[model samples]
Target: MRVHVVGTGLIGTSLGLALTRHGDEVTLEDAIPTHAALARDLGAGRLPTAGEEPDPELVVVAAPPDVVARCVLGALVRFPEAAVTDVASVKGTVLAAVRAAGGDTTRYCGSHPMAGRERSGAVAGRHDLFDGRAWVLTPTPDTRPEVTARVAEVARATGAAVREVPPDVHDRAVAAVSHVPQLAASLVAARLEDLDEDAVALAGQGLRDVTRIAASDPHLWTQILAGNARAVRAVLTGLADDLTAVVAALAALEAGDDAPGARGTIARTIAAGNAGQARIPGKHGGASTVYETVRVLVPDEPGQLGRLFADVGEIGANIEEFHLDHGLGQDFGVAEVDVVPAAAAALAEGLAGRGWRIHG
Candidate 1:
């Protein structure tokens, strides 16, 4: 397929790279010449020459949220014969703009791929970024069925799992799942700005996981949050109310009164959090699976990790997940290998028989 990608940022360049890797012809463009040049140099795609007519089968507008609709409209006008799609995170606002523009709707679809890094720009693009990730397509009532199929084909070509949803539903869902979480991460990370070095040094993996997305490009997030302000504000309001309740409960507990319902309030809040977290889908888009951990002492050497994996493979125990925590100032680390409950005992015993220390 011949494709044209606009905006040369992480999403656009990544799409170009992925499409090109699959033997598709891709042309890249950006508002900034240097950006487009960088994407081209990175083997994402080639830049079209002046007055070169782009007779593409699909045109992907990968602009920021604020200008996504405009980019989509421009692509539609330029490639009147091509199917057009945009990968902006905020769908409702972009759809509203496209509707207001009064452009032909039959060939346009708004899509968003739920994949990204904390970094931005063409230089940060990865061909495999969208692999096995959800790519949402928002097609209005007037969108032609064939046009929608074409957009879905583009998504699938990049190894994404395509999902069809309405613009409003996509906006609200992302506000709760993506936008609000980014804000929460940034808010938590902001509190560490003025903390003492010793206090910061005590941070663990949990803190790293929570604040990881806080490193995203602020300018882009600003535009996205502004575009979806209504939905994001609603989620934030509910979260604020919960925060108020938690704060009040903590204050009451500080006063040494098993005050009316204070303890229960705290417990209920924590329980609710756990319930919500457990509902999140796990690997391969299934409900979270319960796995038991088997801790093994791993010597801090290059081949030690490989040997551990080889040993686990030899035992035929499928590792669901693993984490290695280094023992401070020691020459060994703890490798917590998670497996199905049924495999836990056998894995532990097998490793113990092989001269490996089983912590638990």
Candidate 2:
């Protein structure tokens, strides 16, 4: 398949790299000539030759959310025989804009690959970026079946799992799962900005996990949030209401220990979070299973982590989850290894027998 990727940003360049690696012919383009050259130089794909009118079977418009419609329209016009798709985060806005501009809806399908890094630009492109990730196809009624199939074919070529849904459903789903979480991460990280160095220094892995996506590009996120404003605001309104209740409960508890229903409210809030977290799919998108955690005290030195991993392999315990956390002012870190309930005891015993300290 000959694929033309426009906008040579992170997604576009990454798609080009992935497709090219999959043995498909990929052509690179961007609004900036230098950016396209950079992606090509990184082995993503070749650029168009001078005075050569290149033809592609599929055109991927990986432009930012705000200008995705315009780029998609241009691709549709420029390659009349090609199936067009855009990799913009928001789908409904792009679809609506394309329809309003009288673009070719039948030949167009909007898709969002549910994979990206916090970094932007062609330099951050990775060939394996979409591996095992969800590539959602939001095809409208007018979209031809072959058009959708072509997009899905290339998406799978990059090792992404293709999922089909309506454009409106895609917008609402991402608003909850992706957009709102970004805002939450950014808001939580913002609190650390005004804190004292000592307070910030006391941060743990939990804080780091919650605020990991806070480093996302602000300008790009601004456009995404703005494009999906209605759905995002709806989710945020519910979140705000829940936060209000929590604050009220905290205020009551601050006034007195025996405040009516205050403890119940807080407990319920935490319990609700626990339930939600447990519902998240386990490895390989399998059903969620409760795993028993075996904590080990790891010495702060090189090769300690590698040795621990090798020991776990020798112990025949399959680790389901692993986290390393450092204690404040401590010379050692805690390694939390989660395994099946039946394997946890053996893992703990085996590590202890190997001269490792097993923490409770």
Which predicted model would earn the best TM-score? 2
C-alpha RMSD between model 2 and the true structure = 1.7
Each prediction's whole-model lDDT (CA)? 0.91, 0.94
List clash counts for every candidate, in order: 0, 0
- lDDT tens per residue, model 1, 168-270: 9999999999999999999999999999999988887788889988888889889999999999999999999988998998898899866788888789889
Of candidate 2, the 10-residue stretch with the lowest lDDT total is: 276-285
What does each candidate score in C-alpha RMSD?
1.8, 1.7
**Top candidate, metric lDDT:** 2
* Model 2 lDDT tens row, 1-360: 999999898999999999999999999988889999999999999998998777999999998788899999999989999999999999989998899999999999999999998788999999999999999999999999999999999999999999999999999988888899999999999999999998999898889999999998899999999999999999999989889999999999999988999888889889988987888788877889889999999999999999999999999999999999888889999999999999999999999999999997
Alpha carbon deviation, residue 152, candidate 2 (Å):
0.9
Global local distance difference test of model 2: 0.94
Model 1 residue 176 distance off true place after TM-score fit, in angstroms:
1.8
